[model samples]
Target: MLDIAKLARQMPEIGQQMQKDAQASVKRLEMAQQLFFQANEHQDNLIKAQELWCDRLIFSPGTPVESLDTAIDIPEAPPSHSVFSSDGSQIAPSHHEIIYCYLINIGRIMLHYGQNLHPLLDSIPEIYYKTEDLYGSRKWGIRTEEWMGYQRTLKEIQILTEMACTWVNPPGAHFNVPNLAMTDGSLAFWFLDTLPTEAREEILNPVIESWEQLRESKIPIVGYISASRSTEAISFLRLMACPYDVPNCNNYCSLDNEKNPCQKVEPLRDSSLWQKILQPRQRSAIFRSNSRILDFYPESQKTHFCYLHGGAEVARIEFPQWIAEDSELLNQALSITLTQIDKGFGYPVALAEAHNLAVVKGGDRTQFFSLIEDQMLRYGVRNVGVSYKEARKRGSIA
Candidate 1:
């Protein structure tokens, strides 16, 4: 059990430390804001810095697609449009359970605006119990949880693509409405970096295929991240602050750490910088991600992102290069996103609804295990049991 009394005794000291940290953070934010405006004024110089040192920079910084200071107000959405979103939930395989198995549940939603059509909401659940499914090849060295997560992400996009394709070619009616497809988080498979080359190819190939299908169907898809802590834009500012002719962190900073000039704008996120620059419903300039994983991705499917002030907070929206290059599609995507945020009162309604449908509560997990045990007993399986630790966690003797 937690020692509440001891924790209470330390609250005063914790509060004081937090207060001091907050003050320091405020000072850093002020310095960052000043540097941000200065960088904006000299966008040309920053572009030159990127040209000279982009390949050698240690940190991944965003490459601007347009002027660095560009901020565009949210465009008006089409009169009639559709929005499709998908989210996934997973029950990881655990040893304490009645069975060594896992489940993936994908919740998909479709919403139509300015039309009298009913919205579609449903979840598809799949179970995997085979040894090959549970533990992949030993040579891959991928953890079960990471592998399951990658599978879930792949399932989410595939489902989104299937739903959008159906919308594009409905059975009875011709739905001529412009549409947007979205998922819950970053589209870039950054975690694949941990896997071997063959393992990365196994996971990435299908995802890229789905992206290609969406592109062929002219359906714009995005990944929305709320209160994002990404520092790509801040890293760009650091490039602007480099006083040396060639911006090399390792060559100079490793020898003399105290004199590093970029530390002036230390510890501020991209969202913090945009919060000061963007008004509500405005979006900052789109920037291409410099993730090394994109080297494996096709040029057209490379990840690009922008920050939008969605009334309540700054949100990072990521999409493929195709959407980033098309003005009409980009505007349509941003407008629909802002509209969804308005309807959901800060977050996208489609995503929020999909999350509601995908989430597996504690009660549901308990019931799932109960169902498994009951089935095992019905089949006269004697191996069914729970770990002593699990049993102790379920009940206590006072």
Candidate 2:
């Protein structure tokens, strides 16, 4: 159905554009690298850069905070400990299918490392199919896809929190050991950025409640980013180079390069900068995030992150500010995280297994739809069928 001839004609132009972009990128990269090395070597300058970021960096209306610029060495992991991870996969609402429903499957894994590898617990998939969950009505007050996606994110946080609580206070056994609870990505609820104030609050309130439950459980939970391109560190450099102290400085700073001391590192990612400095199993200083989303988070749940090297590429590991304030818990979190990364060869083993458990195969969906059709027939609604577009996709072989 595609126009191959037209595509072929455009290929040469596309290739030329890509080449030009690549060359420009290389030039900027070299400049960023030079600035990174220069800043890393000069402790006095690094300190100054941090101060400027704290004092003048343009943060969201209500989010103005200081930075924690102390880089602690990676502590050794204990010989025996437990690590738990959770991941979720979703089946989005389909317009082509006879059934208009979505499903979210969360897979959780708890692994204990002592004399040998031991699996402690694994959870069965949780399914929801109530009247409120299946339909998109004016009464629901939100679009079907938006509501379903938001539910999936909320479920992930809730599941992680529930698992952490269960581990801390089991019905049969009691153990007083330090363990780490982790999810696959950043803890910040990114969905809020796309919603209106009231709609955002509806989702955010419950998510924050779940976070509070996890915090009260006193278990260290981390959001692991294997390969990060965040510019939080570079933002510090920009603040150091900022020309004016006024709230709105973009108009003046862009042209006043002479006054901007941090201009050389204007556009650099934190991971790229750390890749040059951190050794295997090393972690950079923990820094508080000035992300606008933090303004909505409860005071106890504000997020902070650190750059780490776990025998692979540099990554960003994020946690709540509460964890960072506690020395013992922070060390435990850093140590266990490094252990998981080493075991999985740069990725966390628990998260990998969780993903594997949560994945929904194509065959599974086909079988599931077939079962739904059978149920419909039993209910005397046999005439319901997939859309014509879906039927055409399954054309006869002969």
**RMSD per model, one decimal:** 2.1, 4.5
Candidate 2 regions off by >4 Å? Answer: 1-30, 33-71, 115-123, 126-131, 135-142, 244-247, 250-267, 396-398
Worst 10 residues of 2 by lDDT: 59-68
Error of 1 at 396 (Å): 2.1
What are the per-residue Cα lDDT tens digits for candidate 1 across 1-398?
89899889999999999999889888988888777778888877787778777766667788888787889998878879999999999899888777888889899999999998899999988887888887884568777777888888889988999998888876775777789998888988888876799988888999899899999988999999998889988888887677787787667565346546776766778888889889999999999998888989999999999999998999999999999999888888999999999999999999999998888788878888888889889989886788888889778785
CA lDDT for candidate 2 = 0.73
Model 1 clashing residue pairs (backbone): none
Each prediction's total of clashing residue pairs, residues at least 3 apart in sequence or on different chains, is 0, 0
Best by TM-score: 1
Candidate 1: regions farther than 4 A off: 171-173, 255-259
- Which lDDT value does model 2 have at 255? 48
Range of the 10 consecutive residues with the lowest summed lDDT in candidate 1? 251-260
Model 1 residue 344 CA deviation (Å) reads 1.0
Local distance difference test, each candidate: 0.86, 0.73
